[model samples]
Target: MRIAVTRPEEDAGPLKARLEALDHEVVMAPLMTITPRASVHIPDLPWQVIAVTSANGIRALPPGHGLTSIRTLTVGPQSLKAATAAGFRAEAQGGDVNGLSAFIRAELTPAAGPILYLSGAETSGDLEGQLGAAGFACHRAVLYDAVPAAGLGPVDALLRRGEIDAVLLYSPRSARIWRQLTEAAGLSAQAGKLRNFCLSTNVASVLPEHWTRLVAESPDEQAMLALLAQKGRSL
Candidate 1:
């Protein structure tokens, strides 16, 4: 089966490699590109814990893995690797920011230590709200910015030719941007032709309204791959 891996480039490596290991032909088409924040600024002092939701945030950290001693809480497995590589002592990893918050609140609670959140410029989940309400002094550091994948001549051509089977969306931003690209490429309003499998319902809901079938995977990438493999077998 031919599967198109559609996360941002920095985040697509593990999933694409895993799919290939499973013997599925994978296409690594990133729907977004992550670049470090040109206006670079990370706090001078370290925090008790650091939160990482995207691998981009990990890769974009300023020179010298500043988060060496900080206990890093990550959102997913792929981010875990990036976080560890960036020198954070990953204490725990969750499926998403919501889950990561839950874990952090449970594990590190009622403490006066500063909690720093490493994220993109635009964040979907309210990590600060959740963590703040739980009594953690959460500070957010925007390490990267996510940009849309424009000039999609190949993806557009593939959809028009009906050669693409499905699209895997890792975030709501990706879903929204890809929907626009698809419509701009004249691929929208074609329901039931290309399946949409998203990381969760929130991601799926952002998809174009014309697509009637959108499958939601569990919050984790392993679960997403499992569900994808299941669908592959069913096909």
Candidate 2:
């Protein structure tokens, strides 16, 4: 099975390796480039906890920011691992923004001080707005930006030759970008023949209506990989 990986290069490494180990041919078609913001300033506020929505957020932190001392709340296991590896004490993990907001609201109170949210320039969820509505003070700092790829990489040729079998979509933005690139390359018909494995329903919804899509039971990389492996077995 030949699978197209459309995640950013840095985030695609582990998944690509894992897919290859499962005996699947992997194509690297990074849909975005993650650029860390230069000169990120940690505000001098009374921050009781830190919130991280993506692993890229943790990677954007400058060394010795003294944020490691604070308890961090991560959106998923990957972010939690990245946070712990960065020397921060990760207190909890949420499946998504809503889960994270609920966790924070249930565990902490308005007296717990403000939360500093580390995020990218384009955020899919409104973590700050959600927390603020719950009487929690949340400050967001854009630490990185995911710039969309100008064109599809090897995917254009692969689809044209009908070599691609499946595609992995991690986010809605990437899914939309993949669709746009495929259309631009005049390979939309070829792409429609391939199966799309999405990390979540939101990711799948962005794709074209006629394309075959599979949504993972859980909104995480591990679950998506498992679904791919299962589909690989059936093929």
- Name the best candidate (by TM-score): 2
lDDT for every model?
0.76, 0.88
Model 2, 37-155: lDDT tens digits are 99888898889899999999999987778788888899887888888888889955678877898888998897879999999998777999999999998999999999999998778
lDDT (10s digit) by residue, model 1, range 1-235: 6666778766777777887888877767787788887767777664887888877878888886556786777887777887777677875466888888888888786574888888888887999889999888888988787887775646666666677777787788877887787777666854236767778888888875567445645687777777777777766
For each candidate, what TM-score against the reference?
Answer: 0.91, 0.96
Q: Which stretches of candidate 2 lie over 4 Å from their true place?
A: none
Q: What would you estimate as the lDDT of candidate 2? A: 0.88
Clashing pairs in 2: none
